[model samples]
Target chain A: MSNEHTAGPHSVGRRLIDLVPHIVLIVGVLIFAFPIYVTLIGSTWDAATIGRGSLPMTPGGEAWTNYSQAWSESHGERASYTPVRLMLMNSLIMALSIAVGKIAISILSAYAVAFFRFPLRMVFFWMIFITLMLPVEVRIIPTYKVVADLGMIDSYAGLAIPLIASATATLLFRQFFLTIPDELVEAAKIDGAGPLRFFFDILLPLSKTNIAALFVILFIYGWNQYLWPLLVTNSADMETIVIGITKMIGTGEAANDWNLIMATTVMAMLPPVAVVVFMQRWFIKGLVDSEK
Target chain B: MQRRVIFDNKLLPYLLLAPQVAVTLIFFIWPASQAVWQSVHIQDAFGLRSEFVWFENFTAILSDPNYVGTLRITAVFSLSVAVLSMAVALLLAALADAKIKGAAVYKTLLIWPYALAPAVAAVLWMFIFNPEIGSLGRLLNAMGYNWDYRLNGDQALTMVILAASWKQVSYNFIFFLAGLQAIPRSVLEAANIDGAGPVRRFWTITFPLLSPTTFFLLVVDMVYAFCETFGTIHALTHGGPGKATETLIFRVYQDGVVNNDLGASSAQSVLLMVILIVLTTIQFRFVERKVHYS
Candidate 1:
């Protein structure tokens, strides 16, 4: 390391080498942020400005008007319009339900698979694991049929439950459970703690970090879901913000409210991106660990 | 990996496993089996009766030139997305890996796009390349470039690819950063001592060392492009401009939902399932080998 400091001949090249990373990274960051910047700027402008096809790079005075229109009134395009607020609430419910539902179900299942001696345990585990291959897109028709038969359509249950059954979550929990020291379990047994007691007390507390990490991923996963929600909910009130924003756009660009649509886009992305940015460490940890 | 000290409750484990097992059975296994069964059978157009016709639907789909074209489109789309996203992410990750100030800021800014839904991502990109209201779109059109994704098939495909790759690059960036950071700094320093430039050191040392991560990301990204990009395609193109951007999964949605051909859709679903199984199996094998080696 010290040898490089004595070299005056290579100083210019080394300085250039140091500058290269900053230059490329700045360009990369700008490109990554450009769409977001454009959308954010578009959200504040009036529809007519956007409708006239003039690119408004600067913020407009219609921030309140555009946001209020997007949030309150259902534009006349669709017969029934869902208020963006209701859709946001619906998205929040669906995402939170999915995240909590998956964590609850998967933890118990992973507990059983990891800690209990039971018949067909591997069968149950493999059955859960096989779901990974059969993504809803592959089996969506039949899955929709099943949900319809269960009379869950147009309900929050329909939107969240089928998607909540997560193999990745179960696998993650199971892997974490396996790494728990056996002596802890033996000590729990000696303490006269039953399975449920140990699970609710010791095991749950031990899994706090994993649960938090998984929550970030699962919540984002739930919030970002488009097709499932699109398929299950035919009604306006049941529409998620993600689906509603797309529906607002319609097919052609002529009738669509560009300002309002961009506003809704910003609203739709807010919660999930906030989750990722706030819980970034956990999200990254969960992602890397789960992929492992 | 069985636990030495295990719970010995007979009914309790079943009780614990009930929710996941039941959901899996109803939502995943049953539907998947139904897809398989429906693929092997043909239903009448009247939605009344069906007959067992083993391999007939598969044969029909194989014989269909449109289906073959879809397969090719999917291959091209998936490969392009994977390559473009990975290359871009790898470059950004490498740049970030260099000793730079505010690297943390760079990473934080780069990764949040991972949280954007594919549909939302498509909508964001659509705003920019809308060929009318989009700034870039308006710029291109003003310059006499006939640019309408809704009208141009190739343009539509490009739009969808860019959107999909945009959404995915963050994921690959995170992984690549991890892989690069895991490389021993000492090794790179030693290479520098041996007269290797940065490019040579990266290719010979950093890249080879990062292959495991790269391989894993390749499989993951391919699968992502196949399945997850459905939202992007559905929102941006809807298999648009005469089915130019239709991937397999989107085709499955179009056929089953819009066209109402249950049997054919199920056949397509089954084919997708097979492809995924193969990809996943290869991934698992490589992962297991990596685990053993480590």
Candidate 2:
């Protein structure tokens, strides 16, 4: 189909009709961008300016002071005073551990289920698959009990380990591995290559795209985790940036440092948003494909 | 769909599956079973006594007015979020799907909000609507409207819903856009050639074709609203202004963690599991049918 067929002979009225999509889309984009824009501008201003309502639309001159204060020390008179730097580091560790751990174990299990015929193979697969119904929130209490029993509470393992038993990633990898041709396995067999070798040499290389895609999704999932970290992490040192920012707000009091909190919010959102924006294609692929 | 030629390994497969299976069994299976067990068994307030109470906890939860209120709130909240987000997303997606300049830029700009945490999104909105320091809130007050979410239950519910829906629009937009793109252009072109206007063609040809994606998103969005909006509610209103915004999930947290009411919380959790299982089964069945059709 040529563009002219859709475009038609453009009368003035027809041209105005054609502009509707752009107009609506621009409005939608502005609505979506406005919050972040406000946050960005708010981060640059001091608390006193923000507190005296009618927030300034323009960036202020306190960007350096606000960011430095937020990054290093706790400014608000909150109970817990963990620095944003420590919280960001904690979030990074948790996110990385979850993404890497989920991928590693899921791929292994997927490889095993795809390549080898063993006793109770379907049983094992179903065991993992059944977990799709059990989110951390549903079984929060019992899971916390189990973690406490294992003495993993307030630890990094507690933060990430309970989250890594992912049915979706395993299912995603398993689905991908099933599409690999049997001829490759046969060729490897004829060459006296063992299962592990074939996996290392063939399967791992083939799964690179899926791995990277899943990593982006899982990393964001890990970073954005709120309830689990809020429950498990007792010490301020173990706080993720997401929970940390909320703590800094401290009941929405006027005494709260709005500028510093906004700065921390920016820092908190930077990594995951950057990942999604930079790896847009893979992130979309991973999300859509994994859900399917 | 098992592979034709497979490895004949026995011990290695178990070894390979150990970590995932171990985690699932220890964390997921065991805790889930414990939830079931705890729902049936009641515990005293202190750390000492316990009693086997069959269906008592379940009955208590079902009979509680607050639980029922939470159930209603969850229904309203999830439906509003799903409808609001999906509606906005569909509009934006339809506009972007048109042959327009800078569609890609609009999509990139629109989709980044999906990366923001629900808590962070709540905080952003809180900053915007905080009545004290919030620009919009101040504007609303200046317009002679009482716009304090912190003091009013209805306002609190509205604020949380807006924040939650704002964060979720990007996700639904991506899916809706993908669904729109997957329609064969020839079919649309034929519709255009048949003298059908754009609006008519959209209603007749486009929407029916998009139903599968629409159905899929509805279920996904409902699940997201039910399970994932905890942070938004927590940060924005703390399920407060007198239990107005407390969804089932938030109520579970309150009963479980804060009040130390383990039995009631476990019962609630089991109910949520049933809800999730039903949703998951529906989703999987629809997906399988979709796969067969494709």
lDDT of 2 by residue, A1-292 (tens): 4675666656576889888888888888898788899999999998888877757899999999988888898665333367889999999999999999999999999998988888899999999999998899889999999999999988999999999988999999999999988888899999999998999999999999999999999999999999999999999889999998888887888877888888999999999999999999999999999988
**Model 2 stretches astray by more than 4 angstroms:** A1-8, A76-80
10 residues in a row with least lDDT, candidate 1 chain B: B126-135
For model 1, the superposed segments whose C-alpha errors exceed 4 Å read A1-13, A76-80
Candidate 2 scores a C-alpha RMSD against the true structure in Å of: 1.9
* Pairs that clash in candidate 2: none
Q: What are the per-residue Cα lDDT tens digits for candidate 1 across A119-168? A: 89899989888888777877889999999999999999999999878888
Write one digit per residue (lDDT tens) for candidate 2, span B71-158: 9999999999999999999889988998888889999999999999998999989888989998899889999999999999999999
For candidate 1 chain A, which ten residues in a row score worst on lDDT? A74-83
Residue B88 lDDT in candidate 2: 97
